[model samples]
Target: MTGEPGGAATDAMQFWDERYVSRRTEHGRIWSGDVNSTVEQQLKGLPPGSALELGSGEGADALWLAAQGWNVTALDISSVALAVGAAEATKEGLSDRIEWVQTDLATWRPSAQYDLVMSAFLHSPVEFPREAVLRRAVSAVAPGGSLLIVGHGGFPPMSEHAHGTDFPSFPSPDDVLASLHLPSGWAVETNALIERTAKWRDEQDVVLVDTVLRVRRDE
Candidate 1:
């Protein structure tokens, strides 16, 4: 959701903290106040269960999943972001259904397997151990569980920020799947590029290309 230099010590955490704090000051919330369309659509047929969300900024997806009867643990690097999300969940009477944790995905190891493990738009500005983190995420999926990952396929028109500037090149669906190295009994449900129209600042509409991957671990 926010981007800054990630190479220096504590830079990633500080960068996210500052971004969320500034967003809270300016907009009160950093992202759109709705569940991501890709997530919503992908989870439509799946039954609710224990879910883990990495980089769950503002908890939109986590809150939505909890409302759909899934117990969720949402992790983010920014305390400000998690605080805002927690307050929102409390206000919605869904606080009991979700657990919020603050940790860097690069180093955090999964303590429990989950029925659903997901990360949406988890691109980082600084060089991150993307492959390693994803591999670990895959390992956290319980048998018969699902893993959903959505990422920016490319920048939209009229955007000032270009690829390889704030972040590295967005990984293709195949790239992500290959990095996971999924073992036998894992089935690829969806691995493709899709397009969605996004409203920037709730003003202009920009068509964003997204790489979506969904996999199911066989029972």
Candidate 2:
């Protein structure tokens, strides 16, 4: 597979694809189904609108957003994961509410703006072509819209993470914002690392350090 971000050593798409193909049983859900406590807490009381979920593995958050009255677009590089997400949406009778796209962020172009743009666990162990990914996500946001980014903080220590996994080390929220290199008009709402338990298939009792940010673009 072509490695856009992180280069030849570990092409994320290939690595994830292999993991999907080799899995013997379900990997158990890794994210909470509840409106994503971090995103919800930061966005509480905020009005809803169109949303886009990046690296939307299995679509748990996307499905939840659709239920919340947001028009949602969920994208992922893994067709296996996308298929599973689509099946879940069908089961929930929400197939009509979500637009699922299979595209590689390494080269995919943003088609339109969204009220909220989100990235959850789209971390990579190696340094990614950070500018490309961040710019793409930011460009997808409409003016007056919000951008939310959540990633595992380097807590629970990188040692606790599964070996050989392609997960990325967490950057501080400020660093993430800086990397986005957003145009002059975007306003920062929140940027910090929030500690919380990952209410999913977490087994190691590891505390989840999430780098969370919420930014609003000027109209």
Candidate 3:
């Protein structure tokens, strides 16, 4: 992310909050309200349990988990964005199932563990410790629980609507796994690129590739 007059945390909050406010006014939302296809696919058949979502923008996945009987902690940096998710959960009578927390993931620490600790698209254009934060989240997963990380491998060809293009490079599934430094007791479950349908300007469907990694600790 481009540097602003304020520090990184302040800059992130201001940038994301303002971005959400503008997008909400112009488009009613910044993202599709549906759960990400990869998240929906990977979580199926797993028994519901306590889950923590890093960068839970607008709460689609969090809301879906709650509807499936999992108590969720949805964390985001922008209060404006979290407000939209909270309102939606309330309207759906699922408010009690989710806890929306507005905190910068870069500096925040988890005091309690959860059965599932997952992060989808946790990248930021602005400077933050991406790998370090993800490594930190590993400590929050309970025994036999899973740590799932999903990221955009890249955008469609010649598409100007590309996202997160500011990064130096997109890490592969193996690159992500090596960065985690997983112990022998843990098992790598899923590490591959998954293709799913995504919308371009809400007018047409496009194929999006995701780098997905799922690792579980021994029970």
lDDT for 108 (candidate 3): 75
Superior candidate under TM-score, 1 versus 2: 1
Whole-model lDDT per candidate = 0.86, 0.74, 0.87
Tens digit per residue, CA lDDT, model 3, 120-168: 9888777779899888898999998999999988867437646555447
Ranking by TM-score: 3, 1, 2
Could you give the C-alpha RMSD of every candidate to the true structure, in order shown?
A: 3.6, 4.5, 3.7
- Model 1: per-residue Cα lDDT at residue 172: 97
Report the C-alpha lDDT of model 2 over 56-135, residue by residue, as the tens digit: 87788888887777888998776667776788889888888898887677667788999999888776543456557877
Measured on C-alpha atoms, candidate 1 has an lDDT of 0.86
Question: Which residue pairs in candidate 1 collide?
Answer: none
Weakest ten-residue segment in model 3 by summed lDDT: 1-10
What is the lDDT, from 0 to 100, of the residue 72 in candidate 2?
Answer: 89
- Candidate 2 deviant stretches above 4 angstroms: 1-12, 21-35, 125-128, 155-169, 199-204
